[model samples]
Target: MNGYRKLPTAVNYQFAEDLYSVFKTFGLDLDRLSYSSQTGQMKKLIEELETPDNLQKISQLSLDADFADMKTKHEAFETIFADQAGANADLRQMTSATAIRKILEKNLKTYFNLLTVMKEVAGWELLYSDTNELVKAAKNSEIKRKDENPS
Candidate 1:
């Protein structure tokens, strides 16, 4: 999949600094937020800017303002991180490889049955032949393994 590429660490650092400058220019207190690193600071800043009153404050700012630039950078950063997080969560939720292979095997069997019935249909002959070749190869491999083992 052509998914989002995470921003580099240096870019994240720059985003935090730019956000700090914009907030400072607007007299927003740096002490009001609690965070350890640049990424954390950016996250906290995003959270702070999401509040109802703060949202109103930012909404009134001109598009050419530093705050506007800060918002754009923050959104880009959030989207990349969110994509990475979602991919990781999906990975964690996946079943074991053996289980996945079993499911795929079952699906392929059902698909081959359909292809067998459709072989008389136009354009399906090549597909059915190709699929049969795959099944033949797999069965031949298994037979070779059994002969070699002789147990």
Candidate 2:
């Protein structure tokens, strides 16, 4: 076995490339977006995750938060799709609502892999629900308030 194998980019950088293909009809331009450069953020962050403290900071991260966070690769693609970066047309033009829904479904494992990684990094704690899906961090005050005063 090779002493040092290349780290997986498929789950990180390739995701961006795949999104470019999926939405290329919407005038998506990976190069114009500086796509190659953008992947470094994930590479760097994943490297930082080697540290316990750094990993802890992201442990409570939900999948939505990962995609929505401005600094993440996921957000870059999100912006393109939402036309936040001056995209040519809304998604409904080339694809239907159903196609949009199914687009990411095939990659749920890749998405789940990210979540599972956070789970292990956080020592398999509260980042996930019993169903192994990422969730919001539990808030004692919020839970108590709700119990004390029902909505």
Candidate 3:
């Protein structure tokens, strides 16, 4: 958890908000098109998550199916994103973010569940604690932002 510990979830809130707006506008998940670096960022996250070392740890718990499901969802998102990125406007209109969001949300839940279960596994305490802290920080930031700019 050396370099992994340093991996930051930090992204400019304004930028993420803008990206979310665009995603809403086009009914796509984030800026899956060539218009943004977010797609690459997501891929990097998955790559980092499946690193040899991480995979080894995950294997110890026999949670490969859960991990595979998460990866499949991400891959599906990527596929839809790539298709939408190249399609004409009319073709793009046929796509909806519902499926994308569903898969991503499910993937997230799977990962969260994994982390929760992993906490009970030996050698996973620090990673689980750190990951939990990151989630709490993100939630707090969202609450603060919402409070400051009530919708």
| TM-score of each candidate structure, all chains considered together | 0.36, 0.22, 0.38
Best by TM-score: 3
lDDT tens readout by residue for model 1, 1-151: 0011123344234444444454555445544643234446666666776666555544443223665687788678668877887898998898989999999999988999999999999999999999999999999999999999997
List model 2 lDDT by residue over 11-82, tens digit each: 343434333333343333334545535444443444444355433434433223543363565556646645
Query: Which tens-of-lDDT digit does each residue in 8-34 have in candidate 3?
Result: 453333333433343344444534545
Residue 117 lDDT in candidate 2: 75
Candidate RMSDs in Å, in order, are 14.8, 29.0, 29.5
- How much lDDT does candidate 3 score? 0.66
**Residue 40 lDDT (model 1):** 68
Local distance difference test, each candidate = 0.66, 0.47, 0.66
TM-score (C-alpha, index-matched) for candidate 3: 0.38
Clashes by residue pair, model 3? none
The deviation in Å at residue 124 for candidate 1 is 0.6
Off by over 4 Å in 1: 1-94
